[model samples]
Target: MATSSSRIGARLLFGIVLLFPLTYANDNAQFPYALTFGSSTLTASWFTKSEGIKAIQFPVDSKYRAYFEDALASFGKRIMRRGEWHVMAGDELVPAPPDTHNEDTAVSLFRDAAQQVSRNLSATLGFEPTYAALTLSSVFNQSSTKAATDAIFPNGMGFIHSIKSLNKVAPAACVAHRLDLCGNLGRTPAECADKDSISNLILVLEYEKEYLYVDLVFVYSEYRTFPSVGHEMLREFGEANREKLLKSMSTYDYNRKLHQTLNAFIESLVERQLIVRVDIRAIVVAGGASATAIAQLRKLAHNAVGNGVVKVVDEIDPGLATAHGAAANNGENDEEIERAAEDENIDDDPQSGDPKETCNNDAIEYIFDEQQPQTFDGDKMKEMYYDKDAWVSGFNSLMMECTKLYIFADKYSIPQLRDDITSALVGHSHGWGWWPDPDIDIIELVYNNLPSSSGLIRLLVLFTAYSWSSSPNVIAWKDRFRGFHPEYLLDVLFAQAQLLENEIHGEGGIPYDGMLNSCVVHEHLELGEEECRERLAKHSYIFASLLSACQAANA
Candidate 1:
């Protein structure tokens, strides 16, 4: 029995030696721990219930489990008793494709569904179901994609589920496609020193672009050409109906409140001759309600002589607009727009009903030719809202306040609180999320404020996931600015493994966010299970783990 024990210990030590070089890169390595003796059998004290595993949780997914088992198998790992499993494969005990790396989240889900089966890999059909007692129990106290993390991306990566996959644009990404058109300026001549000049207007907004575009929207100088800043939208009382045009500008707080000012938009469209004004049924409408606003304006051009009509011509390449405008202005410099923005009154401007009481002047600032001469007429030049009648898919048309979701918890019972936090995590893979706030708002609400076990669970789970997601985002964003680059992840993981190990040695570990959760790795490994933490910090593993989390989120 003593010899047998020595043999097992020798292999484990050998495995750890073999593991470090390939797994941990660019960091000072820690020597292996001394194995306990006097007992003939391996015990559960090491991996499970160790504080280290709770910090920087490891072996993020099935791929991780696979690597560990493969490594242990070479040393003839196995479970000779209950409450344990082992890594036995050298003697044909376990076999998996050697080169197979679990780079995809699909591996985890392959075991998630009932009646799901595949000899190799698949989700729902091949993986164990989430509700399975064994699976849930295995996940109970572990820090893994399944155990601790929550999806942080709004609409989950814009739309993609996998981390390697490209993220879709946010709904607000349309802000990038924003454009403002001006008319009734044919005789106004591009403003030289005037803020309303077309050249200056173009210069302010066209700060930089690859191509220049000049859309000369022509209209008779005789009519009042509305400066198309905000879309002057019309409201509908019923199908094919147009209400009075709203004179007031939309509020940034609720700029999408089309329902409030729909009537004004439709009427103004007709008034602009962009659409036909007719009875809802009588007007030959095409393209559904989306075209209703435009149809009203088209009707205004009928027999009226010298009526205002909008014509769009290529003014310049969109790429060169800013550079050319800037270079063209001999007297104006970069500070010119800032000066104009600083002096211009935001509150009293009749044309701009934008309710943002004060403009930061620099924060998203731009300039363009002031549409219509700088006459302080009580009347607005002209503004148009976005296509509210179009499919306002998601929350486009509603500038709604954020929703607040609060789950109650007492200040005690930290362990059970963790379980509840786990339950919340399971459901987190899907959901629209709360509104009272921004994405990180809830963290502020709960963190440090909760004293109960349950609250700690919630706090830890959310804070960890939030922190984890940030690493990748920050890493990805480093190239955008100076001194912001994230070093390659290889070094990062090596450091993480060191941290988890030290924390485990300590009685309790504060999670990545500083809450204590029972460490399960050492205990589980003692029960013939392989460790998962080191693998989590691996480039391939973290990358793949994020992919799995993303996939689960999209799914």
Candidate 2:
């Protein structure tokens, strides 16, 4: 009775029913199994009814029913092991761990899958997979920091380490997550938080939702949890800069004239009645070149636009924040990352050592197409936070970032990702590291660790590297992407240029060119200011136009 669309799922259930070992416990699975938004697959080991929950959660074998029958639920997708990226529909077929019905094999397999939960292998089930140990704390802060960490970690980040620890998914570490101990107390440190207090004041308009930090707003238009699948408004997050706009909208004085200005501004724009008929995707704010361009944009945007979030990063080392956070997390290893730093001379300032050489705009011009770095003086200096120690720390922090990436990558089964982890373990840079010459041995390590199928993907990237990236398919894909973005074009051009330049014998674009000379960023901008700007604008125009075409087509 299954329709074509549900046929695959139907077969999956049939397989599970047949393969499910009858002797073991048939306990149902639970919710939020892994970080993957939604998942429901639990079965207890076979045992006497008195010993455990008896019966298959659902009568008919259906993915959702099985999950729902067990009181198991998740956000959107299932989490295999690492739970990083989902196995997209087009991915090559691979083996599923439990293979419950050999159903998952037709679809792509997750990277880090566990064949069985709990140590019992003969285990009785519930929620017993993963993790080593969980140490609850008297105070959230005490458990949050590096000071209290055990080498092994808990499954819910800090709740249970091994799958054998318990059955059924437990509530996340809640409440007093001590940020000092580096813990979110007992709660999870999700990416977004909002200023709820201000919402009441802004209710002057209907359809107006409150946003505090706004970065999280990208996930859900408001704080409400929208279903992950269909009928969604936007992606989980907005463009990165969206965070900046949110703060400025909330910037008025509650005391006097400024408060009046803020309130007036909100009323004029967000009141719902003003631009109710206009369906502009978002308000666009443009500012003439000025000393306070950002401020001007904010004021104008709040008055005219409904105030989508606007965020600006320091730009110099945006990577710094991510690295710092990863380092602070106990799951990440700092020493290996630090050691990788010691091997490089990336911080030499390009000026101090060489008598007359300056790493100024002129000096950095070698990579880009005749583009020189923008002459940086007082004004430019103010925009950047360039500290050597911080840079070093950031560089050192990459290993842990690699570790976190590993958790995601391994879970997701990305070929390139697997290679990166392998390379990092042996002290080579993977994707996270600036990639002139990624660490060869390290890449090998990641290759060694992958599941057979995932490892094959890693090997492809490796082979392409030694083969000068002339792989026909890669070239075709790059050429196709180049038609859309100027930046991507620049990268494609450079990679191809380097592939030929190295000739496996010469120097330029050689495999060992270190991070500085090799970073993909080097090729995007030319050294000559005029040429760089011209090309940048030209490419950006192409990208924009392509986007417009796509939008029009969809419309």
Candidate 3:
């Protein structure tokens, strides 16, 4: 077997070899290009370390435009242009012609358009780009279009991934350095001055043949827009009236969509427990339509976000921002590859067990031996609770696992483990909501395994009371109450009475708020609040204090 020192030397040499080519290419003659595939137009921007940035727009062909429209209209179902055909006599099926339209035709069209644009760009610049990053219009940046996009763009070139890395680029020089032009009012500088203190909304409004594609992204400190926040939306206007009534109709449609989009984005953030409304501090507009609708967009944004600074990124052509961002993201990809290579060199010991399996085995051994466990991985438990597929497939099994762990912890006087299990159970319920019949099984398990004085028993009683009281089928719950343990039924009756009293006094309704509070569920008899907080920080558990005994044993 190789010694540890030899492994280290090998890793260093491997890392050097892996990164040398990329470093030399970046230094010498690397050309990175970004292609933003909009609904009506394709914008391509190329960046050179020496010559700077250049962008051009390509007209989309009518057939591809119709395909995009039809794809969106049918909610991403493949639009068949040619009916199915079968060979009547041949032993083997005949291959379809290249031009034949099928599920993959749309992806091919995208690739062909990109190739044509690349040729034109090469002609304009007198050299071909070495790398390309691709982004789709807001309308196509969705789960529905994921398959088509995956086929066209590589793993890391998706709009979300590119924009996420682009946020790391210095915001002040992001546009100015590439285009060799600064913002007119110095607004970009002022907004980017202390990026950590404020959240920025990057809004791109691109005009397509029949619709305006609006894409919104939030960036602040380490926070970003959630993947499911409906980042992209479309506003339709008649294409036939392009010249006569386009401006007026476009303004009205954009204004309405902007309002709706902002509301929905903000509401989603709040609902996901991500951020508050007041956190949004700036709106940065980019895209082809931005210049024309600057005044209206500014007004709408300020009104919606409450004193948020609105700035137009006009230093570079607004439509080129996505392309430029993509080009900037090339460096990030290089770093990711380097890190991945370095990771492969370490952790090569064949004797080491998987961390997750080790953790589980250690816990089981400790429980049986009546000895303190070496560590409690709260993150693993949290993962188990949040896994939607596992919840759907076997929720009762999951709950029973936690219940059994909690019962064992309580019996062995492992307060920290018991508290962690309680927090996990409560968080699971809060995340997925209550399941009626399975929850009853959980109650029986708890009652049979633990005493009435247990905090978990109390929490279940409150949850049961709240659920049954608010449910339309209270009568069914009442009938089911007969089957529950007498102590559990009594505690639930008291909790129901308390809920009624609170409603009567106009002070109740959300028992979960109290149940979710860390202090209410966690035991603090042995550890003080400050010590508990430190333990929690150490273990990274969101809702429970970490086990001091476990930490001591590990140390």
- Residue 555 shift from truth in candidate 3, angstroms: 26
Local distance difference test, each candidate: 0.23, 0.26, 0.47
Show pairs that collide, candidate 3.
none
Q: Which lDDT tens digits does candidate 2 get at residues 422-494? A: 3222222222122222323334444555443343233324333543354465545554444343332343356
Error of 2 at 334 (Å): 29
From the highest TM-score down, the ranking of the candidates is: 3, 2, 1
Question: For this target, which candidate reaches the highest TM-score against the unseen true structure?
Answer: 3
Rank all candidate structures by their lDDT, best first, as comma-separated numbers. Answer: 3, 2, 1
**True-structure Cα RMSD, model 1:** 31.8
In Å, residue 100's CA in model 3 sits off its true spot by 13
lDDT tens digits, residues 1-555, model 1? 111111021111111212223332211111111111000111010111112100000112444344333432332233323123334566654433332233233224322221121211122122221110011111111222222122212112211111122110110011111222222222233432242322211101110111111111111111111122112112222223332224343333222343234334445645865444231111111111223342333233121111232222123322222211112221121124335558874343323455333212111211111121123222221121112222122121111100111122132212322332322222221111111111233333333344323333233343333345335654564454233212213323443554465556742233333212222212222222222222221212232223233222222
lDDT of 1 at 149: 22
Please give the range of 10 consecutive residues that has the lowest summed lDDT in model 2.
206-215
**lDDT for predicted candidate 2 compared with the true structure:** 0.26
